[model samples]
Target: MMNKIFTYSLTLAFCFFSTVSYAKKSIEHCEATQNTTSGLSSCLDVVKEAVDRELQTWINNQVFILEEFALATGRRAALDMFKRSQRNFITFRENDCRWQYLAISPGTGAASAYKKCYILVSKSRIKELEVINP
Candidate 1:
């Protein structure tokens, strides 16, 4: 049982690390081609800022639509839930990225990793919110 648990833990770790690696590799941003850490960091910042703006736009549009629908139909739960969920998601993103930063502490890549994590998570949330009704 102990051996099994250890193996399972290793497998999970491997999968997580490989997915992160694949995501890092698959990014087509200017950061991908940057040779210097500083250059890569700067490019990642720009990319993350763009992603953040897009995410905010999605959130704003969704909230506005939901708010209008709620006002017309007298159903506020959807809007309430959506607002709550968005708050939770933002909190989760911050904590998750903070974890990513801490995971690589004492390294030059931690900040970049944190920004990349934020970009990746926010992009996923944007996709999820895009198709949501109300």
Candidate 2:
């Protein structure tokens, strides 16, 4: 059973990585832009949108897979758990970004810091979910 689980997890990870490899360039480009000051906040906003879309796509795919699994096995708990985990992740991102914002308070870089935090955290979460979920 352990071997089976490991193999399944590995396969899911490979698929997830393959899907997101194409978006890596965009992610890298946005990371590169983080240091620049020319309209940095607005630029981060756009990048955040794109990153958020990627995150959403990943979540949707996971949900669909979980739903299908539930249908086949009649084990609906996994889908519910996944939904809860996603909601918790959102709350975590918001609170974490708020902390990032506060870390730069009384400074002009606060907004950019917040947005950058969101992008970084969201990207990290995407990679994390890809590894952890089917």
Candidate 3:
């Protein structure tokens, strides 16, 4: 009888701890949704800022490596051109901030293969494109 009682007690204790552990700490979505106008706005703003920072962390590393590559290759000219042209380049605008190749001529005029071209890559796309030709 004592052995059975011990087993039952352990099982009950385990279930209680398990349920508590599984419970979420965050308030319910419906509770937030029902909040006053200003409160909801503040909550949304906080969430938005958090999401933006997380996104920046993901893209910042790629920017750092690309900056190093640009300096090493003396390709800042092409990078400047690409940034200026991004608003005009429809295809690049669609790349989700991933690296895009920009071809530029070293001379003042139109771009050409003879003058030399610079390949600009984003950090996110570097691993996949490393072994491949541009």
Candidate 4:
């Protein structure tokens, strides 16, 4: 009975780990296909899309918090300021990433660099937004 229980436990553990490993590999498969420029572009696009979705969610949360604050405090200007600041931040992120891309040559990973910059900056902004209080 003990041996059978041990074997079953081992099998379950193996199956669980294999499933997790497969999921991770599926995500990395895009980066693995980076043998060509287009392949790398596709991988970066996937990463950028994922990060953009998360950023959008965070932005929505921030807006909601600002709206709640405005409703409670009877001050709409705070929400307006938050919206304006968010717009300005978007412009800044675009220009900054463009500058980063231009800093590199025309070819040779410029696009990837820009996409990475966007991902990093947007993720940082999401973290900042997460701390807002209504």
- Tell me the tens digit of each residue's lDDT in model 4 across 64-94: 6667668779999978998999999999999
lDDT of 3 at 18: 39
C-alpha TM-scores of all predictions: 0.75, 0.73, 0.34, 0.71
Give the alpha-carbon lDDT of every model: 0.73, 0.75, 0.37, 0.70
Order the candidates by lDDT, highest first — what do you get?
2, 1, 4, 3
Candidate 4 error regions (>4 Å): 1-33
In candidate 4, position 78 carries an lDDT of 78
lDDT of 2 by residue, 74-123 (tens): 99999999899999999999999999889889688888788878988988
Candidate 3 structure quality by residue, lDDT tens digits, 23-66: 33112332346356445434434433433333243333334445
Error of 4 at 17 (Å): 19
| Span of ten consecutive residues with least summed lDDT in model 3 | 111-120
Candidate 2 ranges beyond 4 A from true positions: 1-38, 132-134
Query: Which pairs of residues collide in model 3?
Result: 99-122
> Who wins the TM-score comparison?
1
Candidate 1 achieves a global lDDT of 0.73
Question: Which candidate leads the pack in lDDT?
Answer: 2
